[model samples]
Target: MPRFISKSLKKVGSSPGTLIHVGEIKTEQSSLSMLHFDAETHIEQPLTDIGEATSLLTPDATTWINVVGIQDIALIEDIGRHYHIHPLTLEDILNTTQRPKVESFDDYLFIVIKMLEHDKEKDSIVSEQLSLVLGKTVLISFQEDEGDVFNPVRERIRKGKGRIRSAGCDYLAYALIDAIVDNYFVILENVGQRLEAVEEAIDSDLDADILEKIHTIRRELIYLRKQVWPIREIITYLQKDGAPLIGEATGPFLRDVYDHTIQVIDTIESLRDMLSGMQDLYLSIISNRMNEVMKVLTIIATIFIPLSFIAGIYGMNFNHMPELTWRWGYPAVWLLIIGIVAMMIVFFRRKKWI
Candidate 1:
């Protein structure tokens, strides 16, 4: 079985809110970029230093600071210094295995969620932890790697194609969250396709290998559920908790996200049930094939029984066998045996047992 929670042994002896990297090392170095925009003006800048990024982050306009990698402990500490981000929230951000959740701080909202995609090369699900910090006029995002499921959102914000430009930081946060949620649908669709392929394979080839595939799909669904199930509560808190960090305009959008989360939960459950049924069906196919073999063997054995009996009597060394001494006895016995076999075959055919 694959490990569900990534090993975080680096955090074994650390303090409760220590900023130790706890996931895979995906990149060589971290990169920071900022997109500051509002109704009429927009600024795009690549940041090399946290101080510069902090200086640019003001309430004058909506800003989005995207940190591509979080393995550098120093960088996380620097951001914490400027934002007054709680140590615990930073801890969760570094721990990629943390479950999806939302929390409100003094001046910001901390959101942790999973970004998942199916890797065709690995034939498995790949997951990453995405942490979002929503403030009054700024939204900071932390990712494990550069480029993400947010490219479409970036395109929208750049073209001013939607309300994202005229919206506050909260709406920008909503757009990001919506993009992530929409990705779930894509991943689930891929899973559904794989299920269909496996289901077809089960019908044509019932073997141990198919059993292994079933187990694999089951594991994938289990992990997906772990990531998605918590999202319901995460969004529920935003929609109902009345968090000041989440704008009133964003409430309806978060509610829509919550509804989508429920749909994802339902899809995961239905797929799980389908996989269970598939396992049972595999067992049934194997059992039925075994029964077929046994039935054929029994029929062949039954047909030879009378022939063996006749041969045994004739081969006995006693002279009291009348049929053995008769001139036509040999041919007569042959005829009788052949007649018996013919009759038995007809009987079996009529009974549909042949």
Candidate 2:
């Protein structure tokens, strides 16, 4: 399926802020996981109800609610009502087509970003919508599917390898966003490797499959561009506009992430140029090969032109023709045709057109 087809198709006539799930709908209920932790204590639980999850959000704890599936309309609505999130924000969360953006609300800061990863099995880029609501002491995340690119951040939080253990909810938000951005680097690396393989294949010859691969990579780059470009704006807003939900100490890290995004954008642009050049290179290769074939055929026809005329002249039966009566006439005509073909071959070889 096309990656972005997760955008709800059933909302053609539905009103705005209607609690209708737009993406894939599953029969199985959505899974909710909770991580409540502070500097001195940590608690992880699997909650079957949003109410259970809400009760655990004490004032001293920093909680991360990861809703594995966003297809449950009632579930999302209940949670939104409990947390005092805006209806429009819930609408965006359900829509799943929301671009990478940051919007300030009365209670929390809402962030919607595309989580991109290279699908090695499919050899394509796959994207999932990740919605984050950053409040004073809690960060709620929503995703379309159960799998995500947040495992590294979860691992870091569990290991306490960094200042994440000591920071507030803002830092946790930063950590999550940072993890997503870091995966961009990995995605780009995979794309770079694919581009390299396509380029190397072009050196030997051109084929329909190679051309298709070029177009596929071009499409991937375009998709990556669409996802990457808007994220720069999101990061810029978070860094320059200084959303209150973000910490003062986290500003530097946000700036660093902004720089990383800038670098990623720069790399994406570079790869785009390279992919464009590869397209031109593919065309040039095909054109040169075509010209080579035409050159060879033209040479063969040029060599045959005089030989055809000579044969045609002697082929007509006429009593007035003198060569027809000679004993060596057939052998002479054969030698003359062979000699002309040899001379043409030599001339073509010397001209470097063979």
The digit string of per-residue lDDT tens for model 1 on 1-354 reads 424746778889887987888878788999999998877878888998877766666676898999998999889988988888999988998888887888888889999988887788998888888999888888889999866898888888788887888878988888888888889888888888888888898887765688888888888899889888888888888887846777788888888888898898899999999989988988888888899999899888898999999888888869787876789999999999999899989999999987
In order of appearance, the predictions have TM-scores of: 0.92, 0.93
lDDT digits (tens) for residues 93-152 of candidate 2: 987777789998777989999888777789888888899999989999998877777788
Error of 1 at 89 (Å): 1.5
- Measured by lDDT, the strongest candidate is 1
| Cα RMSD, each candidate | 2.1, 2.1
| Cα RMSD of predicted structure 1 | 2.1
Which stretches of model 1 miss by more than 4 angstroms?
203-208
lDDT of 2 at 51: 88
Residue 19 alpha-carbon offset, candidate 2, angstroms: 1.7
